[model samples]
Target: MSIPLLKYSLSTQNQRVDGYEVSPGEEQPRAYNTDNLPSSVEMDEVIWAAYRQIFSEHQILSSTSDSNLESQLRFNQIRIKDFIRGLVLSESFRKLNYDVNNNYRFVEICVQRILGRDVYNEREKLAWSVVIASKGLESFINMLLDSDEYEENFGDSIVPYQRRRIIAQRSKGEMPFNLKTPRYGADFKEKFGMPQFIWQGPVRQFRPQEQRPKAGDPALFLGMVNDLATV
Candidate 1:
């Protein structure tokens, strides 16, 4: 039997009544919708936007894109929401995100990317984790995509974006989700035996080559003599 989703309270940290606000000088997010795109070039732009939003890809190559999903979206066979669904359920997403993160961390990432907001708190993380643990990944993704929040924000044609990025009185808005959240968890790095670097030596000044000692410089010979005397 599938477990019910647990209840969690929404925090007011990044909450706002409107999403359309943009400060005078700050650039607004570019919305990409199949409904507005008119040509193949524009369609390609939309595909790029979807990959950027869903996968945090800056410069996606042709081979990296899901050809089957791209074709379906291009032919108007699937809506943008479904395209996003396909990307989320794709094997690349599984290997990069789901396979690397624990349920709690995965829930946090999905809430940021799919829902376009941070998880309210640890309670919310736990709440969604229950769904992942019981219902599985596909069902969890469906629940997020079908939620009223997602429908209201992005709907079927529009790609998802970081919502309410600019707070009313703050000097700076919230950080981009991709920057705030790492691609993989620290535990994954540990499992792979990734190197951890710590600098323990005293700081040293470096000189340019032109200012450095020559091979037979008196300074070099004096340093060598001092080293020999010390030994």
Candidate 2:
């Protein structure tokens, strides 16, 4: 058996360990605060921007006329997240976005779109997914859009975006974005020998380089001895 002596961080597009490119390994913070939101000359421009940010994947934002977007935002008095929810659960979102996706994929997308972060883990994903499976999509969407975590992170005043992550000790100081990934995807379930309906993605086992030994760790001294022996 080959002893896997080296482990790579496996950085890729927009992610890096010690570089300027914004990649996955880093615990990125919110780039801007809602407090001093920019002053746009056109009311429509402002509202349109919010719509695009919330539903960035679809062409829907651009498909929405400036007049309607402006009028709606003005009419609602800019209750940002509420306005977002309306669009997200609209027929357009349902048919265009939700129809093809399975319950797990759908839950994850909604959480990312609305919560601005990945679900905390599979448990968190399943919790919301169960709501979708039993209570149905409307209820599941509402729960995420109106969650306490949502309020705490975005508040009513702001349009949602990705939440900043702090270092998670349990994850060996990995970013929440990385840690919150599903243990497996549809491919992993079918292609691997796992059964269907069970997501197998677990937090990756940290290799030696990704972890540090504690003060009392016997392995710490043992590792040092190993290095000395190599010398």
Candidate 3:
């Protein structure tokens, strides 16, 4: 069963939220699992798509007017960094529930970072546009690029623990078989085979242990996770 997860607590051995530990009262970053939870892979894909749209379409040096493209670019870079920092640096992502708040906050940042504000100083505005549009977004965009099995496990579900009853319950939505990324989900419902869920509408329909296909061909697995605009 999914934990109630009223709130989420982050704890890391280092002070850095990326993967660090610090002294007491500072902040502990709790590790998260991709399975049964929003994953780094998902977050990375969203960030990259947002970055590509903003950086390529908008650039600091592209303008040929009274506007200071350089300054705008810098400001934009800062905004992107600041927004990303909010999620990584905050003690709690949101006030109500950590999981819900964090998820919502993450998506919000990606959108704002991709789309800049009008009132921003000419330099600040342009900077953000350029970064999100180009390589400037690379660093932040790559934050959740890769993940190992440990990171994917989300601290739930045991292998040797052997909870047959629990497994049977969860199996209801499982793909009914093991599969790899990209094409793995394709053979899901081949008469006694598992059912595949592509990355199309309605992500809630996809259950745990489902593999996310490469961002390049998200449509290949749209049935599994919705929100095409996201990836």
Candidate 1 local lDDT, residue 28: 49
Q: What is the alpha-carbon lDDT of model 2 when measured against the actual structure?
A: 0.57
Clash tally, candidates in order: 0, 5, 38
Tens digits of per-residue lDDT for model 2 on 1-231? 422212223222222123343565644443322345445554445555455554553444444434544556665555666677677767656764566556777777677667766545566666666677677788777777777868876777576655544432333454333233333456545666676565669867667964877779898688789999999
**What lDDT is obtained when candidate 3 is compared to the true structure?**
0.30
Candidate 1's residue-wise lDDT over 73-153, tens digit each? 888899999999998888777777787778878888888889877788999999889888888899999999999999988
Q: Please tell me which predicted candidate would have the highest TM-score against the true structure.
A: 1
The list of candidate 3 runs beyond 4 A from truth reads: 1-37, 57-115, 119-231
TM-score of each: 0.76, 0.52, 0.15
lDDT of 1 at 208: 100
> Which residue pairs in candidate 2 have backbone atoms (N, alpha carbon, C) closer than 3 angstroms, thus clashing?
14-22, 14-23, 15-23, 183-201, 184-201
Model 1: CA > 4 A from native: 19-26, 58-63, 168-174, 179-181, 187-195, 203-231
Ranking by lDDT: 1, 2, 3
lDDT, model 2, position 62: 44
In candidate 2, position 61 carries an lDDT of 44
